[model samples]
Target: MDVTVNGQLTQVPFGLSVADLVRGRLPDPRSVAVAVNGAVVRAGDWERTQVGPGDAVEIVTARQGG
Candidate 1:
C-alpha cells in the first residue's frame, strides 16, 4: 500500500507498524516524534500502532538548536 511520509509518497508493506517505519529510517527512533493522520502517537504505542494505506505520517527529529 501507499502512504505519505514527511510529505513524500512512499510504498510500504502491509501490517507495517509505526516502530517498524521509524527503525527503518532513523538510527535512534526514540529521538523523534511521530504523528499519523494528524494524531500524535505516543512513543510507547509506536510498536502497536499500525499505519494504514493513505495515512499521512509526519516524522520529525528533535534538533538541539536554538
Candidate 2:
C-alpha cells in the first residue's frame, strides 16, 4: 500500500500499524506523537491502529533545547 508520510510518498506493507512505523524509525517511542488522516492517534492505540493506502500520516518527536 502507498501512504504519505511527513509529506513524502512511501510504500508500506498492508496492515501496517503506527507502532510498527515508530519502532522502525525512532529509538524511543516514549516521546513521539502520530496522526493519521488528520486525526491524532493515542500511544496506547498505536498497535491497534492500522494504516491504509493514501492515508496521511504525520509523526513528530519531542525534543528539549533552547
Candidate 3:
C-alpha cells in the first residue's frame, strides 16, 4: 500500500501496523513522535494502529540544544 510518511510518499507492505513502520522500517524510531492522519498516536497504541493508503503520517524527533 502507498501512504504519505512525514510528508513523503512511500510504499509499505500490507497489514503493517504503526509500530512496525516506526520501529521496524523507519530510521531512528525511538527519538520521534508519530501522528497518523492528523491524530497523535500514543506509543502504546502503535501496535494496534493500522496504516492505509493516502494516510498522512507525521514524524517529529527531538534535537539537543545548547
RMSD in Å for all candidates: 0.7, 0.7, 1.6
Best candidate, lDDT: 1
Clashes of each: 0, 0, 0
Give the least accurate 10-residue stretch of model 2, judged by summed lDDT. 21-30
Q: Residue by residue across 1-66, what tens digits does model 3's lDDT show? A: 899998889999888899898886567777778899999999889999999878998878878998
**Clash count in backbone of candidate 2:** 0
Q: Cα lDDT of all candidates, in order?
A: 0.95, 0.94, 0.87
Which segments of model 3 are wrong by more than 4 Å? 25-28
Angstrom error at residue 7, model 3: 1.1
TM-score: which is higher, 2 or 3?
Answer: 2
Order by lDDT, highest first: 1, 2, 3
Error of 3 at 9 (Å): 0.7
Error of 1 at 62 (Å): 0.6
Q: Who is ahead in lDDT, 1 or 3?
A: 1
- Candidate 1 pairs with clashing backbones: none
lDDT, candidate 1, 12-36, per-residue tens: 9999999999999899876799999
Return the clash pairs for model 2, or none. Answer: none
